[model samples]
Target: MVSTSTLTYSPHHLNAIVRGSGFPILCLHGHPGHGASMSVFTDHLNPRFQTIAPDLRGYGSSRTRDRFQMTDHLRDIEALLDRLQVDRFLLLGWSLGGILAMELALRHPDRVTGLMLVASAARPRGSHPPISWQDLAFTGVSGIINRVVPSWQWNIETFGRRSLFRYLIQQHTPLAYQYLADSGMSAYLQTSGPARNALNAALTAGYNRLSSLEQITCPSLVMAGEADRHITADSSRETAHHLKNSQFICYPNTAHLFPWEIPAQVLGDIDHWIDRHPQVVASSEVSSQ
Candidate 1:
């Protein structure tokens, strides 16, 4: 049965949800989303594999400062796992979460049995796509400003284009627009500086992180949306090419929000991949900044 609960890992209090029972699947959220975002996929997973989705530091019920960066967020995940007494588990990161998952697989390979990187790139350096002023304007400045002062009364209102905004709310009452509006403020304040920092870091780290990717020992799945406007489809292809043991998949007609747009398909691919890689080296090492 699917269940929702909260846990405190020392200094930080985290809001999380779990479902099914068996091998644990840790779902990490991307920008502007919290742990609750996993509800879409958790509902479709097989009953055998349990799922744990947590609100990253400073998002949702996870409390922290506004300048909290990805490294801090990763440490929060480690602490949460420690609190739960889970020594190891599969990691699934969507978008920004995907970047975190990649970091975990590289730095803490001992703890991560497998990895799923959805719609992420390697820091966007080197020969990576040139960042146009328009791209930066929308992603960096415009996005930050919009979060601080949203145009919509509700969060998912922008999805009105495909009627998905309404349908999702109808399906999952907890994901209503009001919940986003109510929960967004804390995340907005916490991620403001960190988000900018991450963007800057991405520009410098980009294609340069290929060496780190090559060192990944865990099996990985790199999934991208065919129609993603933010990260190009080639990003996933390049990520797979860099990793020692990795595969890639591109979902057609979907944008960056493939998790919400195609949960069943994504979950199916994940379940199958995990089953295929049942034996992984234990990971105890942590990422070195």
Candidate 2:
């Protein structure tokens, strides 16, 4: 029944997708990606649990001024949940969204019944690898060439457009490329340049949350791609270590886009974990703000 609008305005006026009817699963997309970008996971997870995927401010149709900070993003999530009347539920985050998930779990200790981090890290300042300058130069050159030349391709710009989304998927897999292109490219490219810049700055501002993870004593799940270049698997493994109650899984031959790369398996794992917790207070609680 994977039917979802994945668009339109929430009561709070944020752009989001709400689907299915069961225990809630609030999905937070990574940087440069919108609610639709999470369709791969939400579509699968929705069969059992309701999924709430929202386009964070400054991205997709939730356009706002270019300037926004971590606080603003957090407020957006809080307000959206408040409007939705979600009392407690599981939270899932991918990449940058995962970091926000950690912060939010800490903020709403009672609201987040469980936490799931996909290809994410708590201390992103040091955990996630920085994109090299060479990538930037190539994306710019490719964008120029795309204006004139044809077929020859390169990435690194705004990801999913004339950008580096290819690098996120498992390399050399044509189906992976086409899958992401068809399902997520449009939303990824909709990112405003200034908003993208703002997100970039926030990521590099030396933000770290490792020491504070102990406070989030919720049942947590950390899934990582063994081949992820953006965020190392070891870092993800360590993120699980910080949580007093957490499990870590690494998939071989998968990269940063494992949710899209291996949707079925990922969903199975997520389902199994959620079944064990069932939002019981004694089971644990934890996500993105």
Candidate 3:
């Protein structure tokens, strides 16, 4: 069973959900996604590992602020870990969350034992051409509109939300779309305009660690879908190339929503990877040693 709780971090609060037991793994969701986005991992990973998924500030149940900076987001993760007394553990990040995981590993290597980056890019936007036209429309046009529109005006119209959701669903495979729709993820994707703007700014501001990828020393597993329109497979390959010890895998006939489209395959791969890298352990063990 998954347990939900709120952790107060002075001025703001983070909603977190935890499940299973054993090695602790912090799961970070993508932009416009909350802790529940990673909840699927719990269903497949439980009994072997404890999954801790939290809503990032300004998203889901987490408190929102006027401004959402990368530094602030980083602090929130740290604060959540401190509150949970988790000194070290593996980190799994999907899409935007993958970038955050890389940042955390770069900034605090000791705190991260390993990294699992799923359908994420190391370079900032515009670093390379988008893989498809749908990618361009979604990131270039819709992204701008979301940033410019007022929060009150955004998602207020049923037609607008439905249209956007439809487009988003169209990007995924039929199986993936079905899973997302059944999980009520379509509603969750309707984020406030301000939050969307904040995320867009963070992503496009060009403050990235692509150049510093060689600095990451931890073992990493980079997975990407060959058909992912949002982030190209080349990005994942580049990321793996830079990491001292890393593996890259591309799912054939899969897209950005591979987590939902191919949950069993993804989970199995992750579990096998973890088994090969058995050094990843609980925080208490590291402290005891």
Candidate 4:
């Protein structure tokens, strides 16, 4: 079962969802998403392994100010884990969350038993293709609108009271779309405009992990969707290549939203990776004594 609560950490208060028990796994969601966005994976893994998902500052139920930086996000995660009493465990990051996970692994490899990156790259927006004129125009307009209007009002005007199921699940097969709807992911798309803007700025700032990738010594898994437009499979391959110890997998016909599009497969792959690393470590520790 999933339980929800809030944790106050300094200037921010993060909303978190926790489920199951035993070995812990901290799940991080992507941009324009919150902690609940990992529900599909967490629901499947619960009871077998404890999963803690928190909405990053400036997103979801997390409280934030006008601006949010990458460093602040990293600090929030560290404080959250400390408060939760999680000394070390696997770290699973999807999309932007993956970058944060890599940052954590790089900064504190000893605290990360294993790492999983889904549809993510080493650099900010590294896998994304060149922006088209239409995309640029859309962005310009959105930025102006976001700056002018309040987040809740703008969200209501643009998406109305209905869910964002249709607007986000594009390019995927009909079956995938239906599956996402069935999974109750519409709510996951709800986020404040400031949060969205913060993420956009962070991406535009051109953060890269190319030089630091070699420093990550933890066992890592990188999964990419072959058809992902935002983060291409090549980026995932590149990231894995830089890692000293890592495994990479690319799923054909899968897009950026593979976690929701192909939940079972993604979950299984993650489970296998965790079993091979952290679980193996636990077994060896027992045997050694």
Best by lDDT: 2
Worst 10 residues of 4 by lDDT: 1-10
Q: Which parts of model 3 have CA positions greater than 4 angstroms off?
A: 1-11, 124-174, 184-190, 282-289
Candidate 2's TM-score reads 0.79
How would you encode candidate 4's per-residue C-alpha lDDT over 45-106 as one tens digit per residue?
77788899999887778856556556667778888888898877788898888988998887
Q: After superposition, how far is residue 144 of candidate 4 from its true place, in Å?
A: 24
Predictions: Cα RMSD each: 9.5, 7.9, 8.5, 8.4
Clashes per candidate (backbone, < 3 Å): 9, 6, 0, 0
Q: Model 1, residue 177: displacement in angstroms? A: 11
CA-lDDT, candidates in order: 0.62, 0.73, 0.69, 0.70
Which parts of model 1 are misplaced by more than 4 Å? 1-11, 124-159, 162-208, 280-289
* Candidate 4: residue 23 Cα off by (Å): 0.8
Candidate 2, clashing residue pairs? 101-287, 101-288, 105-287, 113-285, 156-163, 156-164
TM-score attained by model 3: 0.77
**Position 98, candidate 3: lDDT:** 91
Cα lDDT tens digits, model 2, 10-37, are: 3225688999977778899887788888
Judging by TM-score against the true structure, name the best candidate: 2
Q: Where does candidate 4 stray beyond 4 Å?
A: 1-11, 126-175, 178-189, 279-289
